[model samples]
Target chain A: MTDTTARIPKLTRKGQATRDRILQAAVELIAERGVVGTSTEDVRKAARVSGSQIYHYFDSKQALIRAVITRQADAEPVPGRPMMGALDCFDALRAWADAAIQRQEENGCRGECSLGSLAGELGAADEDSRQDLSNGFLRWQGLLEQSLRAMRDRGDLRPDADLGELSLALLTALQGGTLLTQTMRDIRPLRAALNAALSYIHSFAADQR
Target chain B: MTDTTARIPKLTRKGQATRDRILQAAVELIAERGVVGTSTEDVRKAARVSGSQIYHYFDSKQALIRAVITRQADAEPVPGRPMMGALDCFDALRAWADAAIQRQEENGCRGECSLGSLAGELGAADEDSRQDLSNGFLRWQGLLEQSLRAMRDRGDLRPDADLGELSLALLTALQGGTLLTQTMRDIRPLRAALNAALSYIHSFAADQR
Candidate 1:
């Protein structure tokens, strides 16, 4: 999102792996303590990498954060979680919601959606980060829209359904519900928000035979 | 919420006014920056108060932050913002949603819900702050539920409607929508989320004669 490709240095496979390991550590730290609370030193220690190693991979903390945002935008890059991308049918959408709630429950509702949390902290704090985050959100919305549009094309939803609004509504519910879930330490808010959004989507479902 | 009354020192009317002034300044700083970014020194300079004067009212920076959270919970205490209370009817709920969107538009979607932004930053970071924020959210949700329950008793909503879930849905929409609005710098996500939630609520409205 930040034209980081031009600045990215070519790396050997080992170097790439090391870079990913550092990025993963940074993501975890950022998840535990927000962007402001996390530092490159912390990431280095967590990654068990040397200072030079981190510097070799990332030019600055802001650049590293941008890379993290790009990683988050790529997909649900978190290793164990189910991919939240597919939404070709109603059941897939429902499964996506259930998986989100289950993941929160599994974590004891301690953390939030990584990208959403970063957006919350960095959205207004930095200009470059804001653009990166805006792109992340749009990419996410685009995924949902893609799926919803496919559903409409397949005659699963009404021809008149507005894919953009519906996708944005779903994304907002997830973002809002996840934020509340983090605070309340309860999964119900997330559950209710997603349920409401799903029902709204269903309201546009083509009448069944 | 913290049993702070016993520890609170008695203040003269003047002292109370001064404390409010400091708090107002702190809120502005926190809204602009964040909890992690705003420091006591910043608040002191912003409020034009001496260090001792700030300490006289708030024991520490964390104490001051807790006070800010308290103020946010006291019914949308931000100056000049429309009171987001009195949701005893559908139109009032719609007005609340519109006011939230209008405020975001006015501010160019820079800041999030004050309580929500605090929750975003503090929810997982500090246990005490998490408790304080959980109470803030519950209090806000309670107000919404109070109004929805009133509507139910008056037969405006169906007797079978789950007021708690409905109210939670509405709050989730606001929190989610507001967070997205802050990131996307657009009002449609907030508007769409609230509209969808309101439509869900209206689906439960009592049948017309």
Candidate 2:
């Protein structure tokens, strides 16, 4: 058989830069115009790359979408959380929620979270995209579940409370609340929802001294 | 000014049928391909109508999108108690959740949600569509809040609990959980999340038995 390796082109540093530019432009365009509204030409122009260059980097629009999914999946809300495992109390949970909401709001909900938007826009057509989204959610849920388990072990939460279920509820509430806040272009409702959810969380934890 | 009312074409019986066919096709296409993937030509083929016929009913693609949003806004999950004002207790609240989730599942979580898809797809380009989606969400929240308030009045929930806040949490959980379920293409996670939220609700309510 012919050497299959010969067909694969390796990206040089400059070629990689071009790819990054294309992806960055795509992210912005997707945020502003949505997956359907965004066109390849728009991305090509936005990235300042020629039409040929775009094709060189991505095989198809679907390939570009996969890139977007991977890029967003790797993104985090903040730089540091190395000690996330150390946060084992209800107070820690409340603080985390505050910080998360603040960062999301400061962004003005304009970035249009990649996973959230994907879930809304491409939930039906791309199974691979769906799996990527599922993995992202599961990753987040696992983090929360780990934190909750620590809290339970520390007697911060009720010993019998189902951490998996609790984690899912909290995650779901946060995502849904964000969607509502974005749609209304207001944060008051989100604040109310978060505080209410926090109160529920508190009730499950051991009483504060 | 000349009377312009007569100039507006009224849809005849056959025309109405064609319009409905177009709308139905549009809904299915949008749900599958998102707003970006759907085209007038695509819709024409799905509806088995000529391209000119589509223009006759809708002036442009944006007009068609507006019609879709309006149609979705008017579509509500039935079989629930009339608003939150009439909900007297926890049983009424549970019934509402059941109906909401049932309808959501029956719809197969198509395209995350028609209104949500529109909101995510249109972004800042369509202010009116955004407003429509925002209004629909608010109306939904209002209905839930009214139900929670009735529960509080009936002493079914803690007197100190904020009905408005709780309602927001409930709605957020439902929306987020449904979206997550859609993305995963599995109902177990959604069921778990909802059951957890419901359990939390029960914990907050005053003991009836």
Query: Which regions of candidate 2 deviate over 4 angstroms?
Result: A1-18, A48-56, A77-87, A111-113, A207-209, B1-18, B48-53, B77-86, B102-113, B158-160, B196-209
lDDT at position B24, candidate 1:
89
lDDT on C-alpha atoms for all candidate structures: 0.82, 0.70
| Model 1 per-residue lDDT tens digits across residues B1-209 | 44343456686788877988998899898888777778899999999999899998888998998888877876462324334446778887777788877878899988843888888777767788888888988988887888888788888999999988898898999888888888888888888899889988887899744
- What TM-score, to 2 decimals, does candidate 1 have? 0.93
Q: For each candidate, C-alpha RMSD in Å?
A: 2.4, 5.4
Q: Please provide, for model 1 over A43-138, each residue's C-alpha lDDT reduced to its tens digit, 9 standing for 90 to 100.
A: 999999999999988879998999998888775623243345567899988888888888888989877438788877776568788788888888
Evaluated with DockQ, which candidate comes out highest?
Answer: 1
* B120-159 per-residue lDDT for model 2 (tens digits): 5564456777777777777767877777777777788888
* lDDT per residue as tens, model 2, A118-183: 667777667777877787777767777898898888888888887777777776666666666777
